[model samples]
Target: MSSFEPKIVTFLCNWCSYGAADLAGVSRFQYPPNMRVIRVPCSGRISPKMILAALRKGADGVWISGCHPGDCHYIEGNYYARRKFTLLKEMLEFNGIEPGRLHFSWISSAEGVKFAEVANKVIDEVRQLGPAKVFIKESPEESAA
Candidate 1:
């Protein structure tokens, strides 16, 4: 109920998490409405720049969801995503971004309940972290020495 409803940007695989999220909606599974989901062909399509872009665009947190490592629609797409996200996580932390501000999960197309659960969990964690002020861009004057 806080004024800071953290903006969560979720990149979901079209064949899995995206379908699962649609199922969650149809099931009327209650979840935080703060997530702005972007459906992609595969999680492998997600890039570090994409995640950082979402944060720069006002996302308080970011998530990338896909099929299980061995279940990616594009053979090993999820595996690739996993590796990329792992390295990106470390880079974000080293760059002054909070480590907890980004996350990743795997959800099958049939797991409507899981989609709702993950969505709620991500929102809760972000809420505890408060607003993503650090992710916000500073104006020219603010960044000026």
Candidate 2:
């Protein structure tokens, strides 16, 4: 019932999380209508810059869901994602962004109910943290003092 519905950018792996999301929709499993999904070939393909860009683009939070480490379609994609996720957490914290604003999970294509549950959880966590303060750059002239 809160008006502060956080806008979340969600990255899903094509072979796993993406399918789960689709299933969730088809099954009518409901979660908060806060996330905008971007399905990628694999979670390993998601770069830190991409995540940072989403935050810069005004997303209140980000959620990345991929195949379980051993179940990755691309063999080791999710493993790499986990590594990148750790680095990204440190970077976000250094940049003054709360680590809670970002979330990650491993989801197989069949777990539609789990997908919905995680979605709701992510939205709730972000909502509790309030809106993210996006990074803004000053104009060249403004910085020329």
TM per candidate: 0.90, 0.91
In model 2, the clashing pairs are none
Q: Model 2 RMSD to the real structure? A: 4.1
Off by over 4 Å in 2: 136-145
Please give the distance, in angstroms, between residue 100's alpha carbon in candidate 1 and its true position after superposition: 1.3
Q: Tens digits of per-residue lDDT for model 2 on 1-145?
A: 3678999999999999999999999999999888999989999999887787788779999999999879998889899999999998998899889999999999999999999999999999999989888784544654584
Report every candidate's CA lDDT. 0.89, 0.91
> What tens digits encode model 1's per-residue C-alpha lDDT throughout 1-145?
4777899999999999999999999999999889888989999999777787788877889989999878887999999999999999998888888888998999999999999999999989989888876654545654584
Question: What would the TM-score be for candidate 1 when compared with the true structure?
Answer: 0.90
Clash pairs for candidate 1: none
Candidate 2 global lDDT: 0.91
